[model samples]
Target: MNVTITTIYDELRGFLDDHQVSTNETILEQHSKDESYHTPSLPDIVVFPETPEQVSAIVKVADKYNTPIVPFGIGSSLEGHVIPYDKGISIDFSLMNKVLEVREKDFLVKVQPGVTRNQLNKELKKYGLFFTVDPGADATLGGMAATNASGTTSVKYGVMRDQVRNLEVVLPDGEIMHTGNLAQKSSSGYNLNSLIVGSEGTLGCITELTLRVYGIPEHIAAARAAFPTVDDAVEAVVSILQAGIPIARVELVDEHSITQVNRFSETDYKEKPTLFLEFHGNEQGLNHDIEFTKEIVEDHGCKEVHFEEDNAARNKLWEARHNLAYAYMHLNPGKKHMVTDVCVPITELAGAIKFARKRIEELGLLGGILGHVGDGNYHTSLMIDMDDPEEMKRAAQFNEEIVEYALERGGTCTGEHGVGIGKMKYQQREHGKAFSVMEKIKLALDPNEIMNPNKLVHSKRRSL
Candidate 1:
């Protein structure tokens, strides 16, 4: 028997303390969508749980009612991971924000799922340590783990999956379980930690995360190298990685993005395809690496290469890169951003990006290309009027074409973003038989299909 929305709301209100449950339309609408172009679906109710027991109790209540429960953190996901499409309950984790422990000696930090990256970093700074996975936004650590997020530093520090030492999960059935222990390495049975990391909240809700941290590097330097063409800049990245330069971050911002950055940042960067690169190590090591990188970039037809030695200048350089998405938004004031992510082998990156640029031009879309090129991942941010059907259709076609191209080249549809609602159609094509295995796991874990249903896996659309 399906419970009515009013009944569920009343039950939730009865179980929670003041400020724990809300049925206000404005708050419900706020929890309905993420930062994507997907249509928003308002949940009937929103609830915040401050402890693992509370989270488990809420899940149990939803299970009894056979109502959908969507776990949300900061609502910063670029895909539709947090959307409560079935008009059920949205479990916001904001109240659970806490940094429980910081094991400085062991290089690990334990935090509640609601803790944002910036919040954790602030506490880690006193210990001279930092977390590596930065997903552009100051998103929650749990959301980062959910999407297996990777960012500018991924080429060196790896993604969210790599940094996670353990996870405390509240399963769909309200069963509390530990994915793994704090051992540095394990040769145990199945890798549940990894399975839950990128499951997009379909398998379970992460309550606490024990993450690996890094010590502050001895020396750091930032550089900007402008190339005659995007192809040249991509090739330079390939050469740098092939030569084993331990670059902390290597991002590519195309000519269009450079123009947007100039407008948004109030700085005059050359309006050309450029590589924003950073190196971290001892002074001698960084100098040697920079020298080698300069030679490689110049060989690839770099027009201008400048290094920033001052800390303020280096921060300014990365701040510009981090703000590229907002810059695109600023440049196109009235349109929504439709970003596409595809990752290929390093050798094939230049060709893929070149093809994307030509395709964007052919489609007559106003967009810019920029991403962490060192990891063979790139994104094209397009500004589109969401209300215009023709423009939306064209954007969909463009995304499909790019994903198909990447798959044809043995690449992935998404490098950092998981298979949320937007990427669902490509899963079967991307994973084939393995896709069935994923569905089977989903059934085993969430038989009622209550945990973020219609996401990551395809199921018949059901009405609330």
Candidate 2:
């Protein structure tokens, strides 16, 4: 809008084609917000850069103009991670979508940041290989690494940070930096991989990545167990983990979520608290694991337990689980979703889930509880009418209460979703004296405040 910003836009058009650099209102609106319930704000410009060199060129321009940079993926993130509040430039990475290399022998793959999980998996399937980190939605690998995202498979494989071995990052001041080597373990320098993984774009923009992949298991199995109460299902999960059975994925879908899934997925799963479980092993080992898991869940009051060995049945079961969120949205037509992600230690998970349900019922909120329970992380997909002040207030209170509870129990306010604008208020509470250390790192990496400003670090309790 001003002369300085106007000059930067003119120069951007000069370097990139007219189509690559856009000031159109429709494109700006599309890049404005993520899938979160947070209010949307448009960026002044949206640029799609196809190469890391182009990213560097654009970053240099942003530095010259002192403009903000908010990297955009597929907008699948639920934490407002990509909102361009200051109306600077939004760098949409969709154009950089490509898998550069797939090393089947080393179990590694190099890809651009814009490549989605589904896209990468489809390519990897040829060599009997697959990327392990799956966050349900078809989010860009760059965004997933930025958020350190994890979903069902995290229990056995770990999160995005674990899968990432190398990162090609474009810094705030127009410099390119790589995080680490492809070695399985490293003890050399400052461990930049961990630092940048969950930074929520506060430090820099990710341009490329070398990720760890996995071979398809020799044999695979899936199961669904029904519990009479939420507490029972949670307890069963805790027991299974305690027994140290190597379960690949264990998800909790409550009765409310089940009913919603049935409505949208057109499947008749019993409307009860249930655990969708999966195992990865050889045929003999998988059978042994399934039997042991069965014994443990039954001990914790699991009434009905069923297993699926056929590939089609297993895929369908996971598909339904992934579509549960859409079901909730479909049921709540005009309402906005306020999703919560809190993870506690295994010992404290059952109590925490029970408390969350009690509070939700007491507040009379329309919501459902589901999550990757094996890792002690859970989410409450709350649907609320944003226009209703009373409902909004209750949702805020419920979120705060659960966060406080998780913190008191030595848990994190965010399990998978990064501290984009959504969890900024909880940073100091969760990290305490160490939160300032984070601020120092943020400043050291992004001193100009050009990369996704007002996000994870270098700020106190503030709204975006």
Q: Total clashing residue pairs per candidate? A: 0, 0
N/CA/C clash count, model 2:
0
Best by lDDT: 1
Error of 1 at 77 (Å): 1.1
Poorest stretch of ten by lDDT in candidate 2: 455-464
Compared with the true structure, what per-residue lDDT tens digits does model 2 show for residues 366-460?
98889788888999999999999999999999999999999999999999988888898998889988998988988787777888889886543
> By TM-score, how accurate is candidate 2?
0.97
The residue ranges of model 2 lying beyond 4 angstroms of the native Cα positions read 458-464
Q: How do the residues 1-464 of candidate 1 rate in per-residue lDDT, one tens digit apiece?
A: 14577787777777798799988889999999999988999987899999999999889888888888889998888779899887788999998899999999999999999999999999999999989888889999989999999998999999999999999999999999999988899999899999999999998899999999999898999999999998899888888988999999999999998999999999799999999999989999999999999999999999799999789999999999999889989878889998888898888888888888888899888898987898889999999998889988888888998899999999999999877888888988999999999999999999988899888996554622
lDDT of 1 at 456: 93
The lDDT of model 2 is 0.89
Off by over 4 Å in 1: 1-3, 460-464
